[model samples]
Target chain A: EAGVTQFPSHSVIEKGQTVTLRCDPISGHDNLYWYRRVMGKEIKFLLHFVKESKQDESGMPNNRFLAERTGGTYSTLKVQPAELEDSGVYFCASSPYRTGPTGETQYFGPGTRLLVL
Target chain B: AQTVTQSQPEMSVQEAETVTLSCTYDTSESDYYLFWYKQPPSRQMILVIRQEAYKQQNATENRFSVNFQKAAKSFSLKISDSQLGDAAMYFCAYRSASGGSEKLVFGKGTKLTVNP
Candidate 1:
């Protein structure tokens, strides 16, 4: 089976530009998550999508960041007026609802490297 | 709140030798899961091995295994007969086994180098 996939393996944009990162998860996966690692920082969770609903977004940093999963399919993360600090590796992961919530093994994608100048 | 820490930023192991990466986490939840993920040059996060908090026996996947200390909140990964392919960034992660909190908390990561 094909694993999770992401778009635009690398992105370069200005500090005030808008950028959108996309993630296509494995088929039949209900739980999708987004995480990012800023320069010199550990990878941190951003948000989670269970089907078409936002299960958890407490990790979202601010309103400038937005995430959406329509029709319970792929997901997208959009950063508006991106700042220099937004330059980092954004990783997307997905897992089935089986194995309970926390027990499920997450499969990650080849992260999208965003560079803001 | 849960936090994971990796004390060693870098480690090296000779081929056919063994290497251990240390990790510690702080969490109030008793039942949870600890995992070790390997990120190679491709930058894809790959699950290496996992240990359930309730399991007393360590979890092993071929040459990779984990030493999980529940009381001490320590989880270390041991790679035996290390190969060149084992040289990568190893990350320790924690996940609460509860119903609502399912996100993984990851450490700063440890870079492992294999010397031939």
Candidate 2:
């Protein structure tokens, strides 16, 4: 089966520009998660989507960051007026329903490297 | 709150040898999940292995295995017969199993270098 796929493997934008990162998860997967790692830091969770609903977004840093899962299919993370600290590798992952079998593993995508200048 | 730590920032091992990466976590929750992810030069976070908190026996996949201690909140990865392709950043992660959320809390990561 095809794993999670992300668009624009690399993105470069100015400090005040807007950038959107997209993630297409595996078919039939009900769980989608967003994560990112800044320089010399651990990978931090951003948010999670179960189907089309936002299950958990406590990890979201601020209002400038927004996440949407339209039609409960794919998800998007948009950063407005990006700051220099936003330059990092953003990773998207998905997994099958935990209630069902085989939800222990998460499939990750080729992260999108965002560079803010 | 949960936090994971990887004391060794970098580690090296000769090919065909064994290497262990240490990880410790602090969590009040009894039920949780632990994971080890490998990130190669391509910057892809690949799931190497995982362990359930309730499982007594360790989890193993091929040459990769985890020594998980729930009481101590410690989880370590052991790679046997290390290969050059195994060189990468290994991150230890923790997730609350009962929160109805699958959010993972990761460590600072340990960069493993395999010498041939």
Candidate 3:
């Protein structure tokens, strides 16, 4: 089985521009999550999705940031009017929807490095 | 509102030696999980090892193992016979086992360098 995969491994844009990062979780996985890591900071969770519905989004930074999972397959994180502080590595992870011990293990993708100048 | 802390910003160890990375977490939950993730130059986060709070025995995976002190709220990773490939940024993370909170809280990470 393939691990989580992300698109546009690196992105460079100017401040105030809009950028969207995409993630395709492993086949048959219903749990998807997004996290970000700023330079010199720890990785923080942004949101989570179970199927097409959001499970949790308390970690979202602000109103400018939005995440969606359509058809319960892929996820996209959009940052409108991106600011300089939004530049960082965005990571997407996924796991099977189960209550067993193995269900807690999340497989991460090669993060997309976003640079907003 | 749990937080993970990795005190060491960087560490170095000679090849074939052993090195331990320190981590401390603050959480009131009795049941939780701890994890160590490795991110190399490729920038891919890989799970190295994990420990479930309910398990009294420490977790071991080949050359990687964890020293989990539940009382002290500490989780440390020990790499035995360190190889050059082990060089990377090691992150300590915490996750609540209940309340349907699946998000992981990560530390700032510790960069490890293995000298040949």
Candidate 4:
């Protein structure tokens, strides 16, 4: 099976610019998640999507960041007027549905390295 | 809120030797999941191993294994017969067992260097 794939392995943009990162989860996976790690910090969760519905988005840093899953097959994260602190690596992961038995294991992608100058 | 902690910032172990990396977490939930991820220099996060909160047995995968302590809220990883390819940033993670919250909470990470 093909693992999760992310577009634009590396992105470099200046402050006040806009950039969108995309992620394609494994086929048939119902759970998709977004996470990122800033300099000197651990990887933090951003949001999660179950099928076409967003299950959780409490981890989003601010309103400037937006995420959408049009058809539930893939997802996009957009940042408007990006700030210098927005530079970091954004990761996308997905897992099969949990059936209340054993917890599911999430598969991660290579991640996109975003640098806002 | 659940939080994972990795006390070691970095560690080095000679090839063919065994090394243990420490991790601790704080959570009020009785059931959850713990994971160890290895991010190589290529920057890809790979799942090394995982342990369920209710499982009494430690998890093992090939040369990688975990020491899970429920009472202490501690989960550690041990690499046996370490290889040069094992050098990378190892992160400890936690996930809530209830609800649809599948997001993982990660620790600061420990950079493991394998010396040949």
Best by DockQ: 1
- Which residue pairs does candidate 1 place in steric collision? none
- CAPRI classification of candidate 4: medium
Give me the runs in candidate 4 sitting further than 4 Å from their true place: none
State which candidate, 1 or 2, has the greater lDDT: 1
lDDT of 1 by residue, B4-93 (tens): 999999999999999999999999988998999999987699999998899999999999988898999999999999999999999899
lDDT score of model 2? 0.92
Weakest ten-residue segment in model 2 chain B by summed lDDT: B94-103
Give model 1's DockQ, 2 decimals.
0.76
Tens digits of lDDT, candidate 1, A22-75 = 999999999999999987778999998999899899899999999999999999
lDDT of each residue in A15-59, candidate 4, tens digit only: 999999999999999889999999879999999998889989999
lDDT of each: 0.93, 0.92, 0.95, 0.93
Candidate 2 chain A, run of 10 with poorest lDDT: A97-106
Model 3: lDDT equals 0.95
Q: What share of the true interface contacts does each candidate keep?
A: 0.76, 0.72, 0.63, 0.72
**Selected candidate, larger DockQ, 1 vs 2:** 1
DockQ for every prediction shown? 0.76, 0.63, 0.64, 0.71
Model 2 residue B77 CA deviation in Å: 0.7
The estimated TM-scores of all candidates read 0.98, 0.96, 0.98, 0.97
